[model samples]
Target: MPDTLYDALIARVRSSTKARVVVEAAALTGGLIDRGLIRSVVDLDRGEVDAIFDELTRGRVLQAVGKNRWRFHHELLREVAAELSPPSVQRRLHIRIADALVAGAADGTPEWPQVAHHYEKAQRFDEAASAYQKASINARQRGALIESQNHLARALENVERLPASHARDLHEVDIRLERGFLSSTATGHASAEAAAEFERCLQLISDEPGLALYATFSGLWSYYATRGDLRRATQLVEALRLRLADMPDWYRAATDAVFGSLAVFRGEFDSARAILEAAALAVESLDSAEIEGAWFAPNDPVAGMYTFVGFTRFIQGDLAGAEESFTKMERRCQTLPFPHGPFTLCYGHTIESLIRTEAGQTDRAAQLLGDVAAIGQQAGFDEWVMIAASAGANTSSRSPVAGGARDPAALEEHIQNLTVVVEAWRAAELISFLCWYDAALAQTLLAAGRKEEARDRVDLALQMAQETDWHIYDAELLRIRAQTHDCADAVEADLRAALELARRQGALVFELRAAADAFRWGGEPHRAELLAVLDRFPAGQDWPDLARLRSLVG
Candidate 1:
């Protein structure tokens, strides 16, 4: 029925070739037409176009929206009219429309996707590719990651239509690199698709050493790092370091940041702290000229370095140092460019929450998690959202547990929710902090008096730590393990090992925790050790561990 109506309208407009031409052109552009655009594309005078527009509007085939604008009353009418033109004519019309749109657009104004749309329809692959890339950048800066990804995919498709050449390959490489970065942000960095894109980019790279290095570090190395494969990440960093003599200062500083993070993963807290601090300072002072052409960079180098610095300092029992580093991180994020602001903020907030939670400030910690979630949601990054959700659940769950509450049902409910979140994280391959969550879940289980379950959870976490070379959380797991056992000998042995491991890692926070647990539950055998650890902290810190230690021995 709709087709019959469209056919009748087409027959009526067919009386004049000019009217038919006008109808076909408008249909080709999806029935959207303005007098200026129609007059530009078609060789019709203003009065003649106005008469055609009046006839179409009177026939109910076109709707007059405003001055010089008209759209098909029904989309099907446009589709039917479009079928009247041959492919050759359709291609000519598309080229004319694209040229007109380009001619009218201002410089630096975002490329209208309509221009790309017409170019693609006209089989003009080169122009289409360029237009799509610009649109992708515009979408990305606006935080529309999915839209950006779509534009990039179209750009890549258009580039593939061009004949093979070194320049084409280079352009393809650029598109893939951009797409891979977007994928890592839209999906998780640990996603297999993101890894594959980077790998493909590396294979295509011939004369672009900087791009190759960028792909290696940002895409490949980051995939492993986010997946908790610290061993592979360390290997990549070491390989990059081997060529340090040929690299720029920014590359060198980025290498330091990556190494610092890997060091923290391996429980080398002191080394990690020094590396990250130096890297943060170097990155802050470097000029734009010194770092030009360096593609191997974090979203925000200064904030990225300080994020690791804060975490390392916190683990090493330097609360003041952690606080100072986090302050710097927050300050830098305020003025970061698009795509950097939310991500750096999320990283900074996550670490700050960890520090806040450790200092017995549950409310503050929860608030930070909320902020991280908001940032992630606003930025359209699901990884941080899931991270915030999982971490938030653990935080709220543990807050009550720390108050000496022993409601098994409530604790079980929390465990179930966390278990669901863990499954989601696993599905998304967001396992960077999987061990941390396991340790937190074990803590909750212990609070509910489920010693057997807690022990099982802690064992799984320890096994994961060993498998991934992620020992940063081992000391805390061992301390938790001490509580799961009923035998006095087993308890003392675990506590002693926890304390030793904490000290070996230079994790004063964990060391004090282990020592405090020893004094409280190990029959005061570790009283002197606890006192020694306590003496290392400043006099007036509000750390929960320090508060617990004072309450116990005073």
Candidate 2:
């Protein structure tokens, strides 16, 4: 438990974001503790609540019309107070108690029935629903499927009583859907139920302009990014960006941190760098009240926003920056629930692996990628599926597992993994990552003696890249096409197009690979010119860039 009333309030507010408003309600209910509005009441000493109220105003969790009267923030609490009905205190009480139970705290365990009594008194059905859902999870863990289903149905009943506009109703549904999805663990459906439920929330949010929208948007971003849909993911981000136009600097900074990975995946590296750089500067804002307030903060999912910023740093090839980000992420995860999920663990290891790989730590990189492969082999088809196959797919694919002196199984395997992601993305209709993946996979396959398969993959890669007008990928696709036809001098056009794009983007690896390929096919002047340029570059064991990749063709 937190030490002070302010700390408790902050923790509450941070968990649900809506709790920020609930904090005001909690105080109002406390106006007369004799009133049953505040239940399972714990003593926080006299003046502690008053101190919290004072900080509430100063913190601007809500605003005041006059000194005596106060309300929650207009953007959050105000609308939520009117249109969005919260679950009953009794119901929320049960959920909290269950959370305590999950945390292994026995003190709150015996209090569930009391919370249920209050819930029945207030007729707060939705909180009852959440409580039931929690009960279901607990029941299922104890191998009580019948009890779990009964609790789940009761939870659904709470959702039924409210109108579509009631955020509590919608939130309950989200909880139920997430729970159901996890329970079913759908193997064949690609977790479409989860994705579809998320989509529903996304649609509903367009009609609401309060805290629900923020919550919905955050969840949607995470869903789309994890599911590999960058275009929609981009829209979610831009929506957040537009919403933050006049928002406080703190919230804006937080949003940037959460969305950093989406931008990185979208290949907007410089833009990602800018967003993360700004977020990296926000760590100074942490304090005890604020830390406790993580529960109240809106749109602060992916705790240790800085941890994600560190990931962006990793993506951008900054080892020191990545280390800093990972450190914050590790700390923040300690405070949040199940901090290391498949997503976080996979990301952590991959980033560490890349850093080690780039720093000439082959043994370390091998250990990291090797571990990733082992864990990922069983996780089934989803994001990890894509990641497991794509590691070192580009540069090291041609080398054997440990980089054979002159063999190409490693490269072939990389291409195979790339093909897997390509097929998945094409099926998922995610064109951007799909295009890049296809182009790289084609090159890998071609180098590995799988010429026929390479041709088809290359054609698709070029088509998608051309369609998107992603010039970086487009050039690589073209050079590939030219090479396939043995177009000789015609290859220069493709290499030049790719070279110009790579130069502008600082895609050093891509540039080298394309030029190297051009030299191999076009020969003479092209070969001599590309080598001269390559010599000017510093030698720190560059990954198999385009220049190196092209050499594999010979």
Candidate 3:
């Protein structure tokens, strides 16, 4: 009684009441205190509760925060009291409270963090691990990616407590995979942390080759692709193909989708399209259950395949086809249940806006880009926000939207904003996106008649693209160069080079645009070949590239 508040609180909880009563009250109160809530102890026997409350209040250990609610005057008082309880007694109380809170809940879902805390305190590590994993999922759904990652780390810590067993290993692998996926999504590219997790998963699941393949395809390839390690990504693709000889249809389909995505990054458009088309068909054939387990859930692999398909078609001047593919992806994503976190959704909207802009749907494109900016900002998706801003700026400079025509001053402001974002990406070592935005900025500068600055920007972009093997925009960069160069002969040479690169990459849209430029620069022999390329596209006449081609050819 004469001791300080902490000592007195601990001694009182330990000696005043039966262990059951003390531990129960401590457990319930500890949880409430952690949540910054104060509660009245009405559930305990009225006489006992009154006596305990009065005793604590008299000692100045508990204080009334509200009319009928009381809390420990200081958090240390509650912590000390909880620590002083017998370990077994504390564990049992934790379990009892966890059960009560988990059951009879208002919502059917458990409060994962609270449940995880109780399970961990009770030393029920397996349950703790599961609860933490669920908490991570919930956090991810709410766009709390760093919180999700922290939960996964705690889950893995609990996983380490279990005795060695196949089930334990599987749990560890699952947690690592989820962590890897979350890290990749949060960063807009694979991080070394994600790669390490995926590598650990591969090692853990070595006996299960199918699961190993899943790990490799789900994360490793993306890491290599994002890092510009095309050779390693190609090796992974080949390994997956070899393994596919014996894998199930769903697995093969998912693997093919991943391979298709890799090929898209490699600028192998024809091969990418073929593989993705097969993947799309395979996904369509899947039954409900197979589809559920086929890809990493919540971020569907089939939806990703459609994203690549749409992007590939967009680059090929098949605007209508690209629109169809993007619409399909959006529809598939809509079917996912709550907490539909950003995955390809932001990218889809960003690119779709670009397509809309090029097709002269300026107002609609502006609205979609606005959505992209908003979603990216809310979700902490910096890469998508940068991409959306770059695309939006370019679109605004070229054509009027709901806003009036962008004057020279507005265009310069957009360029300056884009420069800041691009530099930030560069500083962050987001190499692929940096290169992409450099090209975009170059195009914007060219459009604004800043030929010297545009030339310098495009050259830098081309250098980065070649250094990184990110040739997806190679032809476009060359075309931008053609626009910025002063000499007619230099422009002709640049356009011809662009045409060749576009043809090699099967970027038909770039090819048409370059050929149109060549014809415009008085390279008369390009006329017949340009018409033939334009004729191959069944639609997209309204697209800027095709429209320019048609005008020149006519």
- Error in Å for residue 356 of model 1: 1.6
Residue 38 lDDT in candidate 1 = 81
**By TM-score: ranked, best first:** 1, 3, 2
Candidates sorted by lDDT, best first: 1, 3, 2
**Candidate 1 lDDT for residue 459:** 94
List candidate 2 segments past 4 Å from native: 1-106, 109-124, 133-154, 162-190, 202-206, 225-229, 245-250, 258-260, 283-335, 339-342, 351-366, 373-396, 401-440, 450-452, 466-485, 516-554
RMSD of each: 4.4, 15.8, 5.6
Higher-TM-score candidate of 1 and 3: 1
Candidate lDDT scores, in order, read 0.79, 0.51, 0.71
What's the TM-score of each model vs. the native?
0.83, 0.59, 0.78
Predicted candidate 3 versus true structure: per-residue lDDT over 1-554, tens digit per residue: 33587666666666755433643455454624321111122245555665666677787777766654677777766665666657897787677666666674569677888888888988999989999999998887777889999999999999999999989988898898888877776666647777888788878887466764565456777677767776787787677678766667777787788788778776789889999988888788785345443344224677778888888887777777888898888887677532233556776676677667656666777888888888778877765676677677656654632234335565777678668867766666666545556766776666566889989988887777777767777787898888887798898788889999889888887787787777777767777887888887765346554565587767
**Using lDDT as the measure, which candidate wins?**
1
Model 2: per-residue Cα lDDT over 14-102, one tens digit each: 65544444463444331222112222232343355455556666755545656445555433333333233345543444344333333
Clashes of 1: 0
Instruction: State residue 345's C-alpha deviation in candidate 1, in Å.
Output: 2.2
Task: Tell me the lDDT of model 3 at 421.
Answer: 65
True-structure lDDT of candidate 2: 0.51
